[model samples]
Target: MTSRVNPQQPSGTAPVVPAHRVVVLLFEGLQLMDVTGPLDVYTAANEYGAHYVTSTVSPDGGPVTTTAGLRLVPDLSLDEVDFPVDTLVIPGRPDWWAAVADTALVAGITRLADRARTVASVCAGAFPLAATGLLDGRRAATHWRLADDLAARYPKVEVDSDAIFVRDGRFITSAGISAGIDLTLSLVESDLGPDIARKAAKFLVVFMARPGGQSQFSVRQSPRHPAHSVLRQVLDQVAADPAADHGLPALAARAGVSSRHLTRLFRTETGGTAAQYVERIRVEAAQALLEAGDDALDTVARRSGFGSEETLRRAFRRRLGVSPGIYRDRFRTTRPHGTRED
Candidate 1:
C-alpha cells in the first residue's frame, strides 16, 4: 500500500499559531484592580475553554508592591519578556505622572511596544503608554477626572472624556477602574468570538455590554455659569423646577430679549442651545430621582419634565446611552442589589 500523506502533517507548511500570549505589565504603586480586573477577565475566558497564555512582568524581574499594599511577584521582568507578544496590557499606577517621568521604564515600554502586536492601557496606564508616543494622534480615554489633564499634557493625543474605553489602531485605552474589564471583554470578543465573550461575561456576572457611557459622577453637579445674569437666572429657574416650562420663547421673554438673540446668547455663553440646557437639567433631575427613590417611571418622567415615558426614554438614551429603567436598575439606592423583599 502507498504510504498515506497525513493531511495534518503537510510538509513544508508554516507552523500553526500557538495560544495567544498576554503579558500584563506591573509597576510599583499600580492599582491592584487595574491589573487584576482585566487579567481576571482573560483568565475567566480560559476557564470557559478559550486558549490564552497569560503572565505578568515588571520593570525589574522582581516583586512589586501595588496600591492596595499587596506585593506581587511577576512571572518575569522586562528584560526576560519574550519579543513580539500577542497582547501587552499596562495597568495603571496611582502616580501615573511619576510613572511617565521614569525614563528607563518608559524606554522599556517603548521597546516592548515596538514588538507587541497589540498594546493596551488600563485607566491611567494611558499616561505611560502615551509617554511612549504610540498614543500620539490617537483617540484615547482615561479616567474622566484626569482626561482634561491628559489632553493638556499630551496635546497630540485626543482625549475622549466620555468614553468607557477607546480603541485606535492597535492601542486600547480605558477610563478609570472598572472600565478595564469592559475593554478586555471587547478584546475577548474580537479574539475568541462573541459567544465566548458573552459566556465569560455571564460567568463574571458583568453586563455583556454595560448600558451607558462613563458614569457622569461629579461633572453633572457643576455646569458652567453663563456670564449673562439672565442665562444664569434661566438656569436657576430650570433647576428650581424641572417640571416647569423653560422653552426658548419663555426664556427669551424672561430675559427680555428676542428669541434669536437669546439663542445666540445661549450658544455663546453655554456652548449649546437653550433646549439642550433644559434637557440636561431634566436628565440630571431624572438621574437624582432614580438614584434616590423608587418612584414609578411615568411619575419620574413627568416630574423631570419629560412629559411622557417615551420622551424620557429617548432623552436618557440620547444623553446616557441607557434606558430609564436600566439606569435606575444600575443606580438605584433605594434597595441593596440582588435583594427583593418577599
Candidate 2:
C-alpha cells in the first residue's frame, strides 16, 4: 500500500508513506555525482506520480565531504536506521579500495544490506559491496577504469566491464559516473512500469533505455595508432574496413616494410603483437555490428573479418569474456532499460 502524491502539493505537507524506501549509504571521499544522479532519477519518478522515498545515511550520522569538495549531510546514522529498506544504494569514492579495508564501514554496509530487500552500488561502490561477500559468484559492474581492479580484488565476483549496469538477482551494480541514472531508471521501470518510466525519462531529457552499453565509451575501443607515420595508413585501412585482408605479410607489403620490421614496430608502438592487435580490432568490429543490427552471427563474423561464426564467438570470448550473442543481448537491453540494463 502507498500514498498518491499530488504534484501540486508539497511532499512534506502530507503524511506520505511511499511504496518504496530507498536508503543511500554515504561515505567519506565519495563521488557527488554517484549520489545525486540516481537520486534525481528517483526524484523525477516521484514527480511523475511514483511513490519513492529516498534517504541518505552515514556511519556516524554526520556530514561527509565528497571528492569534489562538496559536503553532504545524511538524514541519520547507520546505527539509527530502523525501518525496512527497499533498496540500499552504495556510492563510490576515489579511495574505494581503502574503504573496503575499513572494517567498520564494511560491517555497517553488511548490516544494512542484510536488512535491505535489494542492494545496489554506483560506480566503484561495487568494491565495498563486494567486500561484504554479497556479490560472491554474482555478475556485477563497476567503473570502466576500476573494473579490472575490482575483478583482481574480488575473484569471486564476476565483473562486467561492458555493461553500464548489471543485475544479478536482487543485487544491482552500475558502472562509473552517470551509469547510476541508467541503473536507477531501470529500477523505476521494474517497479513503476514502462509508461511512467518513460515519462520520467522524458522529463529528465535522457533515454529510458540508452542506445548502447559501456563499449561505446571504453578506452580500449579507441584506435591505438602510434605517432609514427609508417604504421598510420595500414592501421587506418584496418580500422576503416575490418573485413579487408590484414595478414602480417599483407600489412608489411602494404606498408612497404619488412615483416620483421612491421612486427617490431607493432610491438614497440602498440605494445602487442600484430596478430593480437588484428584479433582485437576484429572483435571490436564485430561488437559494433552486434550492437547496431540484428545480423546473424555468421553474417557479423564475415563483416567484422572473423570469416566464420565460430571464429567470431572465439574472438568475442577472448576479448569480452562473452559470446557475440550475449554481447548483443546485453547491449540491446537499453530500450530505456527494457531488458538490456536488466
Candidate 3:
C-alpha cells in the first residue's frame, strides 16, 4: 500500500486522508499469491473506508502468465504511467534468480524506486532490488530457502532469513508467500492506524500484526551428511532424547570412538562439534516445550535438558537472542474459549 504521511495530523487528531497509489510490478512466471496477498490487504483496508488506490504494472502492460499457468492482465504498462507512485511492490517467482540477471527489469525497478515513497519486495524479489544496488548495505529478508543464496550473491546486503519481514529505511522485504500479507498489513498500520489495520486483518482472518523479526516456521537441521553409521546412530539418539547422557565421554562411548576422534569426525561430517549439535538440539526441544504450554522456567529447563534455569536462560539468549519467558510469550499457542483447537 502506498502512503504519504501528512504533517498536519497531530498525534491524537484525525489523520488527513488521501488516495494513496499502490503499484504492483508484474512479470512472466511470477508467483500468483505474491501478487494477490498484498493486494487483498489494501483492498480490505479500502473497504474499511481507507483510501488505497491499487493497480498492477508490467514491462509491456500485457497479460502475464504465472508459474502456476495462471494469467494476470496488468492495469498499466511502464511506458503508459504518468503519475507518481506512493509505493512500488515487486512480487517474486520460483525462478527469481533468472529475473535478477535481467538488466532491463532491474533498471526499470531502480527508476521506479527512486520516485516511490517506499519500495518493497516479496520473497526472492529482494534479488532484483539487490541487483539495482538499492539494497546494498541494507538489512533485508527473503524466503529461508533462498537466504543463503541472497547473502552469497550480494555480499554487501545483510540477509535475515529468520525474519517474517524486515524494514530498512524505506525499503521493505518479506519472507515467503503468505508473509507478503503481514508486510502489507504493517504498512497499512503505519499509514492509516492500528484500528484500520486490525479491522483489515480481521476481515482477512489473520493476525492484526506480526513482528517483523519473528522466525520462519521451520526447524533447523544439520547440513552436513553423516560419514559413518555410528555417527548417524548417535545423531538419532540425541534427537530422540535431548536429556540423555550426551557428554563428550558418553557420546564417544556410544559412537565407539575416542572423545578426541569423535569430536574431529563430528565436526567433519556434521559441520559442527558434538557439543554444539547437542546444544542446538536442546534449544529446539526447549522451543517446542515453550510453545506448547506455560510451564515454569525451571520445569522447562529440566525437561529440555538444560538442567538449570540459568543455563537455559543463557542458552536461549545466545541462540535465539531472547529470554525463555519472552520466547514463550511470543510463540505459545492459544486455544479457543469453547474448544481446544488452535
Candidate 4:
C-alpha cells in the first residue's frame, strides 16, 4: 500500500526540505583553489538558509596533499558514501592524464555520477570525467590552454575552450581556477534562484554575472616559433597602437616589406591574414575598455581603433556573439565612490 500526504489547507505555508547533498571528490596533487572556490560559494549560501550540505571524499578517506603542499582530510571515503548525491564535483590536478589511468577511481566516479543529479568538473578535472566515458558524446569545457589537448585525447567529447562553463545534460565543466566560482554560482542560481546567487556573488565581490566567455581572458601572445620577424614586429605595433592606421600598405611600410609579401608571410606564419589579426586585437582592446569603465560607445570605438560605434558593434557581434552595450552591462566593474579614474 502507498501512503499519501494531505494537500488541503496549505495556503501561506512553507514546505520543509532537506538540504541538497554536495560531494566533492578529492585526490592527491590536485589544485587547492578548485576545491575551495566552489566550496566557498556553497558555504556562503548556507548563511542565507540551509540549502546545501557539503562533504569531501577520497578513495581511501585519508589525508591528501595538494600540489601546493597543503594537506586536506576527507570527510568520508568513497566506500563510506551512503546517500544519493545531489551534486558531485571533481577538481583537477596538474598531471591529470596520469589520474585518468586509475581504473578503480574511474569506476567509482562512474558509479557516483550514475546516482548524482548533476556532475561537474573544474579545469583539468574534465580529464577524469572524460576517462569515465561519461563525458563522451557530450559538450564540455576546460582550461583554455588544455582545450586542444583535451579534444585530441578525447575525440568523442565536444570541447568548447572559449566557454567559461558548459552544462550538457547532467554534466557541467568549467574553465580554469576562478571559473569554478562562476560555475558554482550558476549552479546555485539553477538550484535555488537568481536572488540567492546574486547575493552570493555580491558577497564574493564579483560581478553578479560575468560577460563574454573565456576568449576575453585568453592569451593573445605572438607565436614563439621563429618564422617571420617582419610579421611579428608588425603585429606588436598593432597591439601597441590599435588606433593607428594599420592598413596593409602602412603595416608593410613600417615592417619594410611589400604588401604582397606581408600578406603572404602573415598568412603563412600566423595562419590568418594581417587584417583579421588587426581586427581581433581591436576587438580585444574594446572589450577591455568596456569592462573597466562606463565609457560611451563612440569613445570606446575611437580608442579601440574601430573609429565608429557601428563598426565596434558589428565587430563585437561577429566575434563575441554579443553587443558592446550588453557586454558592458554584464561585465563592467562597480567603482568605489571615492576612487578616481586614472
303 Cα displacement, candidate 1 (Å): 12
lDDT of 2 by residue, 12-35 (tens): 675343478889988899999999
Compared with the true structure, what per-residue lDDT tens digits does model 4 show for residues 1-342? 011112331545543335688999988889999999889888766555435778899998898999889999999999998999999999999788877987877888888899899999999999999999899999999998899989999999999977888889999999998899988987887898755666667778777555325362633663444366787688789889999999999999998989999989877887788888888899989978988877789999999999999999898888777778766654543533223222
* Candidate 2 residue 139 C-alpha distance from true site, Å: 1.5
Candidate 1, which segments miss by more than 4 Å at Cα? 1-18, 211-219, 222-247, 250-265, 277-342
Query: Model 2 off-target regions past 4 Å?
Result: 1-18, 211-213, 216-235, 241-342
In model 1, where is the ten-residue run with the lowest total lDDT?
A: 1-10
The superposed Cα distance between candidate 1 and the true structure at residue 271, in angstroms, equals 3.2
lDDT of 1 by residue, 1-342 (tens): 011222343567542334778888888889999988888788777666566777788888789899889999888889998656888889888688989989988998898888888898989999999998889899998998889989998999999887888888899889888988888887887887766666667768886544336443533355666788877777778878989878889878877889998888888887788898899889889888976787888899999999998899899889877787766654432333334221
TM-score of 3: 0.72
RMSD of 1: 9.2
Clash pairs, model 3 backbone: none
TM-score of 2: 0.68
TM-score of each: 0.71, 0.68, 0.72, 0.79
Candidate 1: clashing pairs of residues? none
lDDT of each: 0.79, 0.81, 0.82, 0.81
Evaluated with lDDT, which candidate comes out highest? 3
Mark the 10 consecutive residues where model 4 has the least summed lDDT.
Answer: 1-10
Q: Arrange candidates by TM-score, descending.
A: 4, 3, 1, 2
